[model samples]
Target: MRRITTVLLDVGGVLLLPSSEVMRAAIGHSGIDTTDEQLRRAHYAATAATDANGGPDRVEVYRRTFAKTCGVPAEFEDAVHDLLTDQFTGYTWQRVAPCAKEGLELLLAKGFRVGVVSNSVGTIEEMLATAEVCQVGGGPCAAVEVIIDSAVVGVRKPDPRIFHIALAEMGADAAETAYVGDTARADVDGARSAGLWPIHLDPYGDCPDPAGDHDHLDRFDRLCDLLTSRSGE
Candidate 1:
C-alpha cells in the first residue's frame, strides 16, 4: 500500500523449486511411480502443511506431508521420506521456477529494485546464479541489488534481523519494499514483523489465511500484475 519500490524474494518455492529429476529418482528408487505435476503439487502441499503446523520439526512435517500428498502408503512413507532427504540435501533445490526470470525482468522494467532474502544453507547466491535466475550484479541473469542468505547472516526468518540485513544492503526502506515467499509463517509473518509488505506465493491455493492478514498470489505473473497495477496508483 505504501508503493513498493523494492522487491525482495525467497529462493526456494518462489524462484527455485526442488529438482524434479531428483524427486522422480527418489520416488522411483522407492518403487513408487509419480509424475512431474504430482511432484509439483506435492511440494506445495508439503509447504502448506508446514505452514499449518508451524512447528520446529519442519523437516519431518514437510516429509510426511509430501509423502502423503504423493499417495505413498503408510509402510513406504518413511522409506520415501528418507530417500528424498538424502537426495535433496544439496543442490537439488536449484531448479528454477518457470516464471522467475521473467518476473524479475518485469520488476526491473517497471523501475523497481530487486533483491533476495532467503532461509538457505549459505549457497543461495551461487544456486541462483547456477539456475540463471538472478544475481547481485549484472550478469546473464536478471541483476538484483543484493542477496541475503540467512545461513550466512546468522539469522533466520520470523526474525526481523534477517530482513533488516537485506534492507540495509539494498538501502531500501521497509515500508516501500515487498517480500515475496511461499509460506505464511516464515514469509508473511516475517515480512510484516520487519515492517515490509508480505506477499505469499500460494500457487496451490492451499493457505487458508482466514484472517486475510497478507496478500496472496497464485503465480509470479499474478505478482507482476499486482505490482504493475500498484505502480499505476
Candidate 2:
C-alpha cells in the first residue's frame, strides 16, 4: 500500500443524508402516518431492489416499495418522492455527517488533496455550500478542490471512467488515490475498476461479503487513521 495522495468521496450517505427524523416528518407532513422504523426498512428495501433489478425507473421502484412498506396512500406517493429527492435543496432537511467536515479538514492538514465525486442532480456543490462545508474559519477551504458531479458530466458511478475524470482533474494517479463511499457497487467496485483503493463506510454493518470485504470504517474521521496506517505500511 503506497502513501495515498488524494481522497475522493461520495456525497449522499457519506457526507450528507436525509435524516431519518426529517424523512419521517416530511412524510407525516404529507399526511402519511409513517414510523421511523418503516422508513429505515423502506430505505434499505429501495437500495436492495435497485441493486437486484436495476433500470431507468429506479425512482418508481423505490416509490412503490416505500409506499407499500409505509402504508402510504397513492396520493402521498408523489409527496414522498418529492421530499426525498429534494431534501438536499433545503439545509434544514439534510443531516450532515458529524465526521465529514472534520475529515476533510484533517486530510487537507495532512497535505492530501481531497475531492467529491457524486452522482447527484448537478447540485452537489450547491448542497455543500449550503451546508457551509466549503468554508472554514470564515475562509474558503481548499480541502475540497474538485467536485465531479455525474449529472453535470453525463456519467454516473459504477462507471470507472468517472473516477478517471476526477483523477485527471487532480493530476493524480489512481494507484495513490482512495475512494470512500457507502455503496459497495457504485463506489467500492467503481473505484477498484479505476485502479484505486476502495474503503467502505459500513456504519450499520449490513452489507454482506465481497462488497463489504474491503477496509471498513464506521465513520469518516476513522479514515485519517486508515491513511496513517497505510503510510506506515
Candidate 3:
C-alpha cells in the first residue's frame, strides 16, 4: 500500500519465457498441434496449476498441466510430459517476454529501481543478458540494480530470506517495494512474507485468487501503470 519505488521481478515467467521453438518441437513430437499464442497461454496456465497443486513434484506438475492445456489427449498427456521432460531445459527458457525491455525502460524512466530475484540454476544473469532483457549494470538492455539467483544465494523463494537478500542489495524498504512474479505459492506468498507487495503476472487470467489478496497484471503495460499509480498514492 505504500508508495512503490523499487520493483523486483522474477526471471522465468515475468521477463523470460520458454523458447517457442523448443515448445513447438516438443508439442510436435507429441503429435499435438498448437499455435504460438496457445503455447504462451499454456505456459501461464501450467505455472498456475503448479501453484495450485503445491506439491513437491513441481516439474512434473508443470509439464502435465502444460500438456493438458496444449490439448493433448488424456492418454497422450503422459507421453507429452515425458517429451517435455527430456526437451525442456534451463536453456529452453531463453525467449524474452514481449515488450520486456520496453517495460523495464518504462519503469526506469518512471524512477523505479528495478532488479531481478529468480529461482534458477545460477545461469539467469547470463541468460537475461543473452536474451537482451536486462542486466545488473549498464548494457544494451535496461540496467537493474542486482540479479539474485537462488542457486547462487543458496536460498529459494517462498523463503523471506531470499527476498531479504535482494532488498539488502538494493537498499530498498519492503513496504515500498513490489515483487512481480508468476506463481502464487512462490511469488505472492514469498513477497508477502518478506513484507513487500506482491504482484502476480497472470496474463491469461488462469490463476485463482479466492482471497483477492495480491495484485494481478495482464500485461507489462499494466505493470507500468500499476506502479505509477501506486507511486502517485
Candidate 4:
C-alpha cells in the first residue's frame, strides 16, 4: 500500500451527495419504479463517464450512464436525465454524506495531510464550508491544505495534471499520497496515473472490475481502519 502522508478525497460522492430520496423521486417522475439501492448503483456507474470534458457536459454523461444502468427506455431517457441533472446540480437537492466530518477528523488526528480534489461546478469550496467539513471539531483539527476544483483550475479527472496540481500544493509526493473517490474511471484511473495509490469508496461493492485490483472502502470512517492495518503490515 506504500507510505501515505497525504489523503485526497473527491467531494461529490465522498462528502457532498445528492439526496437518495430526491433521486428516487426524480427517476420515478420518468415512470421508473426504482429503489434507492438501484439509484445509488446507477449513481456510481454514471460517474464513470465523467472525464476531462466533465464540466458543461456533466449532466449528459450522468444522464446516459444512469438511464442505461437502470434500464430506462429511450422514451424516458430525456426526462429522467433532466430530473437527475436537476437533483445533482441544485444545492437544494444535495446533502452531506454521513460520517464525512468524522472521517476527515480521524485522518487529521492520525497526522495525515488532507485536501480535496473535486470535479465541481465552481461552488464546491463554499459548499464544503456550508457543510462544516474540515473545520475545527470542538478542538484543534486538521485543516484542508488545498482544494483543486475542475471548474476553477480548468482541468478535470482522468487527467493526472489535476492530481499533480494538488500534490504540488501540498508539497507532497505522489507515492506518499492516497486519493479516495467514488468514480472508477475518473478517480481511480486518474489517481493511479498521477502515481498516487487509489482507493474506491464502494460501500455496496458494486465495482464492475475484479476484486483486489484496487483497495476499496465500504464506508468513509473505515478509512482509518485500512490505513491502520496497512501501517501495521
Q: By descending lDDT, how would the candidates be arranged?
A: 3, 1, 4, 2
Kindly indicate the candidate among 1 and 4 with the higher TM-score: 1
Model 2, residue pairs in steric clash:
none
Residue clash pairs of candidate 1? none
Model 1, 1-233: lDDT tens digits are: 67778999988889999988888876675677888788889888999999998889988999888888888888888788898888887478867886888888888888889999998888898899998888888789899999998889999998999999999987899989889999999989999999988899988799957757778888886676787676566
Please list the C-alpha lDDT of all candidates, in the order they appear. Answer: 0.86, 0.74, 0.88, 0.78
Can you tell me which runs of candidate 3 are displaced by over 4 Å? Answer: none
Sort the candidates on TM-score, descending order.
3, 1, 4, 2
Q: After TM-score superposition, what is the CA distance of residue 117 in candidate 2 from its true location, in Å?
A: 0.6
Score residue 14 of candidate 1 by CA lDDT. Answer: 90
Candidate that scores best on lDDT: 3
RMSD (CA, angstroms), candidate 1: 1.4
lDDT accuracy of residue 33 in candidate 4: 84
lDDT comparing candidate 2 with the true structure: 0.74
Candidate 4: tens digits of C-alpha lDDT, residues 119-197 = 8778777777776675322423337888888989999987999999998887998988889998777888899999998
Q: Write the per-residue lDDT of candidate 2 for residues 58-89, one digit (tens) a residue.
A: 66775566555677777877777676666524
Model 2 deviation from native, Cα RMSD in Å? 4.1
User: Residue-wise lDDT of candidate 3 within 140-184, one digit each (tens)?
Assistant: 888999999999999999999999999999899999999999999
In each prediction, how many residue pairs overlap at the backbone (N, C-alpha, C within less than 3 A)?
0, 0, 0, 0
The lDDT of model 4 is 0.78
